[model samples]
Structure formats: C-alpha cells, structure tokens
Target: MRILSFNIQNLRLRQGAGQPRLDGARDRDEIGEASALDPADRRLSAALLAEAKADLVLLQEVFDTDTLDWFNTRLLPAAGLPSYPHAHCPPGNDGRGLDLAVLSRQPVQLTSHANVTPSDLGLEAPQPGLPVFRRDCLMVETGGLTVFTCHFKAPYPDPDTAWPVRRAEADATRRIIERHIPAPSQGLWLIAGDLNEPFEPDAEPAIQPLLPPFSTDLMARLPEDERWTYFDSHSGRYGQPDALLASPALAARWPDAIPQVLRAGLAYEATRHRGAHLQGVGRHRPHASDHAGVLLDLPGI
Candidate 1:
C-alpha cells in the first residue's frame, strides 16, 4: 500500500501572493500578488491529491470532518481514490481554521481517537481553550496493520519558545503510542505525519527520546544522500519535517514497503502571475504547496 503525507498549508480557500514576509528580505514586496490565477484554489489542491495516487493519505491543515468528507467524496475521485470509506479529521489549533485529516481507501477499522493534551505531555498548567494548541491522533487498523495519523505543533523561529512546546507535543505522541501498542513487537504500527522536527537524529532533545520505542525513521533508513521530505519556500532550502516511524516487526515483515518520499509534487516551479512580474521573479500562484508529499509503501502482510 502506498501512503502519502502532505502539509497542504492549511488548505485555505485563498491563494497567497509571492512569498511570506517572514523572510525579512522581501519587505518591499507586498506578498499580496500570490493570489490564485483562477478562483478555485481548493480545486487546485484537490487536483494535486488526485495525481498522488496514494492508497492512504495523511493531510495536515484541514478544516473539519465535514470538509474532509466533502473532499473525499468530491475531490479525491479525480485523483484515483474515488472512494475512501474511512476518514478521520479532528479540529486543531491552526489560527486559520485548519485541522488534520486522514483518508484511506484500504478499509480502515476505526480503533480510537486520542486528543494529545498538554497534561499528557507533563505540562502542569491548565490547558488553554485555544484550538491552535490542540493536536489529535487517530488509531486505525486494516487487515492487521495499525496506522497512526498525527500532526504536531509548528516550530516558529523562536527556538526558546517553540522548542519546548513542540517537544511536549512530541512527548504526548510517545505517550499515545505507548498507551496503544506497548511492545511494538506486536505488529505493524506506523506513526505518520508532519512531526515538525528536523530530520536530523540529534536535532532536539525532546524529539530524540521517542526514537527507541517508535522504531526507525523511514527517511534515515534510506541512504545518507537521499533524505528530504520538505522544502523551505521562504528560505529556498530543501528539508524534511514530515516523517514515518515504523515498528521493527512491521519493518521486518514488509521490508519491501520501505518508505518512499514522493517528490513529484516538489518538481513544480512557481507559477507567475499573468502579465506581471516581481523584480525579475514571477509573482507566485497556482503552485501545489510549500511542502511536498512524503509517502510509504506497505505491502499486505
């Protein structure tokens, strides 16, 4: 089975102009020009999903269950997933009304849904009511394979602040996994999503601790030269933040299902605005997403 993970940038109805102002270098640029050439930005995002041909898809930055159902019924059919009878979408803390959703054509058996709470991560303070801090996890089973769909907190530039928050979130994920599959030697357990931590093994102390029980990073399993899952649209640097962590038993069983980070979506160059250019660079619009899709192929055990 082929699984794909993509952080569709909140799946917002509106298309942004140019690049984000966070880069600080483009202060003079209004960034407003990144609006879609066509009115249907959602249609464009849906079209990209169709092209991915993924058997299981973990989509970040979604709205809610209703929107997910609509996308599954209306948009994905064109992408070869005409019917995904199983879907899980939980509301999240993206200020822009975005959330997380998973779509699977592979007859998923609904097992459980765990809300990654601040308390679960050892945070002593009472949780805030804000939806942005809410992270969700869905445990699913299909033909003996266990799949975990997860999305973590976004890491801002302030490492001092963002690091602790994301680390807690990562810890919460580890707790959830431990709660469900104690001894990973049991069966195929996959934790797949936009973990938001850099691919480097020793990048963060918070994220590093989970590596033991979580099996191996799919990207790390590949050769040193071939491991990147995302791109920094603002920085123009290639990186990998999304990840797939599989249990050792699962990896041993479906060795051929080794992770395959799909790069077809990243091959796209920015689409320039019609009849207008920004400082020798095209005004952006109609691109797939800031991050490309990462995939894993798991054969039936």
Candidate 2:
C-alpha cells in the first residue's frame, strides 16, 4: 500500500454569493488581504496528490468533512485523479476549525480521540481537564494496518509555554498506542502526520515518547540532508515536521522503504529546495502548501 501524509494548510471551503471557493494555502496572519491565487493554490494541492497516487492519504489542517468531500469529488477529478470514494474529516480541537482528514481508495475504519483528556489517560494536564491532543489523534484501520494520524501542537509564539502541552500530547499518544496495541513492537502499525516539532536542534523534543525504541523513524532511512519536509518561508528555515513513524516490526519488514518527499507544489520562495515546482507556483502565494507531501510505499499490508 502506498500511503501519503500531507498538511494541506488550512483547507476550508467557503460559500459566497457565487459558487463556493476553497481557501488558499496561507494563514490569515500571513497576509492582510485575500490572495488572488486561491484557486491556483488548491489546484497545485490537487495536482501533487494526483502525482503521489497514494492508496491511503492522511491529511492535516482540513476544515471539515464537507471540505474534504468537495475536494475529493471535485478538485481531485479536475486534477486528473480518480475520486477517493472513502474520505473522513472529524472535527478536531483547532479553534479555526482546521481538522485532520483522510482519503483512501479502500474503505477505512476511523476513530477519533479528540475528546480524550490528559486526566482520562492518567497523565497530568498542562491545562487541567483539557484534551491532551492539540488537534486530534485519528486512528485509521485499513488492509490490516492501523495508522495513528496526528497533528501535534505547534511550537509557536512561545516554545517554552507550548512545551508542556506538546509533551502531554506525546505522552497521551504513547498511552493510547500502548492500550490499543498490546505489543506495539510486534504490531503492524505506524504513526503518520505533521508532528509540528520544534526546529531548534538543541531544544528537547516533545515527541520523544513516540520516537526510537518505541517506533522507528522511517524518515531516518534517508540521508540526513534530505529528511526535511517543511519550509518556513518567513524565516527561510527548513524543518522535518512531517513524519512516518513505523512500529519496530513494520520497519523491520520494510527495511528499504524510504519516504518520498514531494516538493513540486512548494513555492519559489522556499529556495533551499532547488527543485522543480508545479506549474503556476509563484514566490509564495500560488503554492500547494508550505509543507511538502510525504509518501511511503508499503508494498503489502
């Protein structure tokens, strides 16, 4: 099975006086005015997904089920890709309505852990009684593979203040995985999503509980220099927030499977990636997303 994980930045569908329109791949904070390239941005986003041709696509930052459905049925076919008959987007904790979504050729069983609080998992909460996950940890089971797709809290305005929340989220995720899979080391599972890890090299990682001895980092199979999947256009900094972490058994089974980071949809401003861009991708506005799509080809379930 070829699985793809992408953070299609803030994909929301809005209805105005005319036909409905999708939001561009930019945050409101980035620009004071609406982008003229909203259509171009979504087209590139669809184009990149078409190119990947993944059987299972895990997405982050989608608005809701309606948005996912419209994109799957309309934009996907318009981009010369077949519609994903099965798509899911459960409401998450994001205040802006940015949610986790999935698109798959085959049917999938999805469960949401959006309301799982730190107290429920026996973990101390950073903000008492609130959900541990910043967004949601969506569990998708398909073709005998269980995938825990997450969109962790970003290390934003203050990494220091954000640390505890992310740490609790990581710890909660670990506990959830442990409860679901009796022996995760022997299970056929993987965690795929934008972890939103801090970019500072020396800073302690909040996602440590989900790394190494617990689950193998599949991105590590690539050369260190090639592991980056996210680009900060403002700071001109590159980071590897997108991850495909596999269970030890799964990683052992596919020892040579390295994820393919598709950057064709990125903007020209992300110059560190001296590669091709999708047609019409401009300096920043007309782009698929700030983050590249990460694809993993697991031949068999």
Candidate 3:
C-alpha cells in the first residue's frame, strides 16, 4: 500500500464562495469553518491526489469532517478522483479548527485521543496550563498497520518558546507510541503528518526525538534539496515540515521504500505554462498546498 501525508493548508473555502477573503464566506460565522480554496484550487489539489494515487492519506489543517466529506465525495470526484470510502476528521484542540484528518481507499477503524491530557502523555504545558497538541494525533487502524496522524505544535513567532513546547510534544508522542505498540520491533506502525518544524542544518532541529530508536525518519535519506514539503509564499523559501515515519519493523522490512516529495503543482512551470486553472491562482500562492505531499510505498501484510 502507498501512504501519503499532506498539510492541505486550512481547508476552508473562500468567503461568498469566491470572495477571496475570510469575510467573503457565505456565513460570516462560518469564517473559520469553510476552506480558503477556490474551484481552481480544488482542481489543482485533485490533480495532485490523482498523481499520488495513495491507498491511504494522512491530512493536516482540515477544518471539519463535513468539509472533508464534501471534498472527498463531491469536489474531488467532480475533478476526477475515485471515491475514498473512508474519511474521518475528529475535533481536536486546535483553536483555529485546523485539525488532523484521514482519507483511505480501504476500510479504517478510527480512534480519538484528543482528550488525552498533556500530563498523561508526560508533557508539561508550554504556558504551564495548556493542551500539548497544536492539533490532535489521530490514529487510523487499517487492519495491518496502525497509523498515527498528527499536526504537532507550530513554533510561534512570539516569545520563541514554542520550540521547547514542540520538543515536549514530541516526547509526549513518543510516549504514546511506546505505550501503544509496546514491542516496537514487531509492530506495524507509522507516524504521519505535518510536524511543523524541520531538521535542516540551519534550523533548530527539533524533530530528532521521534527518530531511530522510536521510528525511522524516511526524509533523512533524501538529498537536502528534495527534503522540503513546504514552500513559503512570501519568502519563496523551502522547508520540510511534513513527514511519514515508519516503525522499526516496518522500516527494516522496507528499507528500500523510497520517500518522495511531490512538488509538481508548486512547480507548474515545468509543464510549459500549462495547467492554467491550477497555476492561475496569482502572485500569492500555489494551487495545491504550501506543503508538498510526502508518500511511501509499503509492503502489504
């Protein structure tokens, strides 16, 4: 099976359906509910999905289940995608409502650990009294493998302490894995989603806690230039924030399963000014997502 992870960038539609801003939404109260994507964006995203052809997909920055259902069952299908029979998005701690979600071509049992407190996960609050997950770590049980999909805390612009908070969050996540899959060497597990930081030599490198002993950091094997999943709209800088981490058993068995960072949509010019609908989004952003999709092909159980 091929698994993919993408941070779809706040799946809220533009206001007034095409108003282009948060205030343009049909229901002003739905400000944070709808996706910011226009029809063009949806089509662009669909193309990426079709290109990926993943058996299961882990998503981050989703608004609500209804929106995801609509996209999976309706929007994407209209844009030419086979229906994903199973789609789920449980409410999480993200105040912005950009939660973790999943899409699977196969059946998946859903489990929610959104209520798991910081202390229970061996974490102290960043503010001394707060939830650790910037968004929840959703677990998807696909018979053969248990996939923990997460959107960890983002490093904040203020105070600069979010880096430490993110580290603690990593500890908490590692603990969850240890507790759930006690015998890591024998279990089929994967940690997938937008971890919100990078291991670039120049960066703070906060994600190492989740690697090696706990799981394999698939991105580490890629060349530095191909490691980025996110491209900044303002600065045009590239950084890797999304990852697909495999457990020791899974990684060892599929050591040659290469990881890929698909940036076709972001680099639409490669198609000789084609894909007008997807590429016409304008001066600000690319069509699919700020974060490229990361994928891995796994051995079937």
Candidate 4:
C-alpha cells in the first residue's frame, strides 16, 4: 500500500483583501482565502500529491472537513487525480485550525485523540498543563494497518524550551500508541507528518519516542544531503522534519519500503522562495511549505 504525508501549509480559502491571511492570521479557524488551490504553491502541492499515487494521505494544517473536501474534490481532481472516496477530518488542538486530516481510497476507521491531554494520559504536566500532542494524533485503520498521523510541536526560533516540550509530546505520543498495541495481531502501525525533528546521526535533539524499539524512521537509508525535506533560507539550514516512521513489524514485513522525500516540488534555493513570494500568489518556489511531502510504499500483507 502506498501512503503519503504532507503538511500542506494551512490549506485555507482565498482571503479577502482586508481579511487575515495565512501568514498573519491569529484565528486558527480563519478560512482565509476562497481557495488556495488557485495559487501556485497549492497547485504544486496538489501536483505532488498526485505524483505519489498513494492509497492513503495524511495531511496536516487543514482547516476542517470543508477545507479538506475542497482539496480532495477540487484541487486533487484539478491536478488530474482521482478523488479519495473516504476522508476523515476531526479538529485538533491547534489554535490556527491547523488540524490533522486523512484521506483514503479504501475504507478506514478514525478515532481522535484531541481530548487526550497530559492529565488523561496520567503524565506530569510539562508546563503546568499543556495538551499531550501539539496537534491531535489521528489513529487511522484500514485492513490490518493502523497509522497515527501527528504534527509535533514545531521547533520555532527557540530551541531550549521547544526541545523539552517536543520531547515530552513525543513521549506522550509513543506511550499512547503503545497502550493500544497489546499483541502482534493488532497489526502494524506508523506515525507520519511534520514531526519537527531530525534523524541525523549527530542530531542533538532526542526523538527517542519515535526510534528503535518504538518505531524506525524509514528515511535512514538515504544519503545525508538527500535527507532534507525542508529548507530554511533564514537559517540556511536544511532539515527533514517530515517523515514516515513505521513499526518494527511493518518494517520487517516490508523491508524494501523506504520513505522518500519529493524534493522536486521544493526549490533548490531560498532566493526562489522569496522570488515566489514577490512574484505573487500561486508562484510556489520556496514558499509552498517549508516542508516537503514524504511518501512510503508499504507492501500489502
């Protein structure tokens, strides 16, 4: 089975001239523009989604069911792709309405962990009391597969505070997933999205919850230079924050299933992103999303 993950940078509506847009919008529920699909960045995003030929898609930064439906029914088809029959969009905790969403061609069941906070998980409050996941962990099931799509706390300009919080969130996510898999027959699972961390050999941040005995980052086999899924012009640093981390059982079953970053959709330089921004809406370049789409092919059992 082919699965793709993308944090489509707030796929909201086209904003009115005086309305709040994606960049400056404070309200998470803001439906900025009429449809971002008409823009170049969104078109590039749609094209990449089509290229993956995935059976299922886990999308981040979606506004809600209506926005996801607009993407699935309008954007995907406009990009010359078949519409996904089954889609699930349960709002997450993000204030920007940047919720986690899933689209599948096959039937699947969904459960939202949006209300699963630190207190519910019985974990100490990292900061008085914060939500366990930065965004909701969407548990998606189809056949013998269970996929948990998450968008961890973003490593913003600040690293010290964000690091610990991210770690705590990761630990919480891992614990939650583990609580469900009591036996092997429960089937294989994986977590995919813009998890805001790196898998670099010398990477300082600890992503232990999504590593080793917990799960394996399938992008490990790629060369270092090719590992990046995002390019930050301001920092001049390239990172692979988005990933398709899989269960040990699933990896063993589909050993050849390696995750791939679709770099073709991203610009090679930061200047291009700026140029796109200057050029106007619809010009993708560096601004589509600082992140790229990561796709993995899982062999059918």
Which structure among the candidates has the greatest TM-score?
2
Supply the TM-score for candidate 2: 0.97
The TM-score values for the models, in the order shown, are 0.76, 0.97, 0.84, 0.83
CA shift of 185, model 1, Å: 3.6
RMSD of 3: 4.8
Model 3, 1-301: lDDT tens digits are 8888887766753335554322111122334533443455656666778778899988887778776776787666766778798888889988777888889988999877777767777666645345666678777988689998888776546325667767766777877877888887678898888887843422545666787766888787797666777766445566677877888888888888889877655644233223333444433333676667888888665
What digit string (tens of lDDT, one per residue) describes model 4 on residues 251-289?
778888877776556554643233123122232242355
Residue 126's lDDT within candidate 3 is 48
Model 2: CA > 4 A from native: 126-128
Which is superior by TM-score, 1 or 2? Answer: 2
Q: Per-residue lDDT of 98-209 in model 2, one digit per residue for the tens?
A: 7999999999999899999878888876565887787899999999999999999888888887787777888988999999999989999999998888777435688899
- What would the per-residue lDDT of candidate 1 be over residues 1-301, giving only the tens digit for each residue? 7788887765533223852211111111434544333323445456557766777788877766766776677656754557588887755555455567778877776543344455544544335322214456667677677777667665655555666666666666666666777776565788777777743433445466456545766677787546666656565566667777788787777666656654443423422112222122222344445565777777654
lDDT over C-alpha atoms for residue 132 of model 1: 19
What lDDT does each candidate get?
Answer: 0.60, 0.90, 0.71, 0.72
**lDDT score of model 1?**
0.60
